[model samples]
Target: MNEPWNPYDVMPAARSADPAAAGARIDALPVSERWKRRFRLIAKAGGPRLPNLGALTFGERMAVMFSVLGLLFGPLYLLCKGLWRPALAYSLIIVAVGFAALMLGLEMLARGVGYGAAVLCANRACALYYRQRVLGERPWL
Candidate 1:
């Protein structure tokens, strides 16, 4: 039996189906290629269940990285990015940690807790910001 010669049959599936090809496709995006590569690496680190980094822009990825590394300035960064809710939430977490540490008479522990909370908040904020910007989803926090 002869098969029909449908043009659709010859075309490749969406660019995202193959991981290697997906990287190349992402490189072609208008944003900085270096940032795209870094975002790809970050997404890959999250394992198979996570979506690739094509949805985020270079600026967005940088924002996430900066927020994660610069804990003290993270809230300011978020605020400048128009992420007021996240900034407020992070600030409140710092305040709560401070209060708890004061009640426990452990001032040094408060610093550690604040730093830890900042790291955690930065990660969640990255995901939340990505969802909001790329998927048009509301902030989970």
Candidate 2:
């Protein structure tokens, strides 16, 4: 039979028994320092689930607010993150929204709404990516 998921039993690298030392090791990943910081925050919270806006500290709240820029830069960000399927899906949804708004004489409002969807999609996709990679969550989810 085939092996189960996370077959290699992925675990943190070079982590000692100390919790602080284990958490601090996120810095060694190849991502930018900015991302390393975010990952550290995520690790502390037991991995990157969606942000509970009301529960966040100031720094975490700032990070959530900063991601709002995805409303404008969603396609580019999605592509860079190697999430091409979501990028394509968002483009199609936006086009449909624009067409519907034009028919309803509400084109301008539709632009805002459509772009806002991108921010939501970005957050969901990133969260799913992290869960799949780090926690070995099922592929279907």
Candidate 3:
């Protein structure tokens, strides 16, 4: 494995007999490319494993940090990506944030926080969903 890292690398694709699962896997597959970089950053921050972020080139660093589709659309984007479970969870989070916004009199702040949380959670949520549906592994985040 001496080859340098490529952001467009195809992840290990898992095939399933179920058509629905197959479709979901299709959506979840691309996430690995993006999330692989993001997860490396997350892992480097004293998580389960700490990898060397300094090794990433400038382009790779940009890939790990910048994404707004998830932030702009939030859970709706998750649903479009065949991640219903995460969408549901994010919806509940929005509801809770709405309640807090009402009580705290900071509607914009609460909504902003909720949307930001979705961006942070989106990749890992996709990783977990892909593992569970495609690999038949228990999905835990």
Candidate 4:
């Protein structure tokens, strides 16, 4: 052979249809460019930043958000039922099903708005966390 093999010289386009080609393209990109691409993908998925809730791997964000929403509604449900054990049990079920229904409804209502709200909320949460953790600012409510 007239030339030595060079993996870097064999890089492919980022939009290549083949997985191997795409991997090669990413491997050839600079770290900052790679992160930029990652953030773009997250933004496309309705995240405000690279690591927003929408940017979390698939079902993880869903589980976390659903759990929080369920917790928020739990006390109201218990009050509405007025019985201790049954109220707790039914409240749990309602939270589960209600979360599912609400997700579906939001999808049907306007996916853009729903996802935008999720992204905005995630951004605000991230900002608050950073302020509290790094700046030693305590939140009062």
Candidate 2 wrongly placed segments (more than 4 Å)? 1-28, 51-55, 121-141
Candidate with better TM-score, 3 vs 4:
3
Minimal lDDT window, size 10, model 3: 42-51
lDDT values for all models: 0.53, 0.54, 0.52, 0.37
RMSD per model, one decimal? 12.4, 7.6, 10.4, 19.5
Error of 1 at 32 (Å): 6.1
The best candidate in terms of lDDT: 2
Top candidate by TM-score: 2
Model 2, position 130: C-alpha lDDT score: 46
Whole-structure CA lDDT of model 4: 0.37
Better of 3 and 4 by lDDT: 3
Ranking by lDDT: 2, 1, 3, 4
- Give the RMSD in angstroms, all C-alphas superposed, for model 1: 12.4
Stretches off by above 4 angstroms in model 4 are 1-110, 139-141
In model 1, the Cα lDDT at residue 127 comes to 51
Per-residue lDDT tens digits of candidate 1, residues 47-115?
122454455577754544545443556666566544567778877887888898989999899888777
Q: What is the TM-score of each candidate against the true structure?
A: 0.52, 0.58, 0.49, 0.21
TM-score computed on alpha carbons, candidate 3? 0.49
Residue 38 alpha-carbon offset, candidate 1, angstroms: 6.1
Clashing pairs in 1: none
Expressed as tens digits, the lDDT of each residue in 1-141 for candidate 4 is: 236423224223223123233344434433355333543333333432234455466654443233232244443332332223333444465456556757788544354443433443333332222222222233221
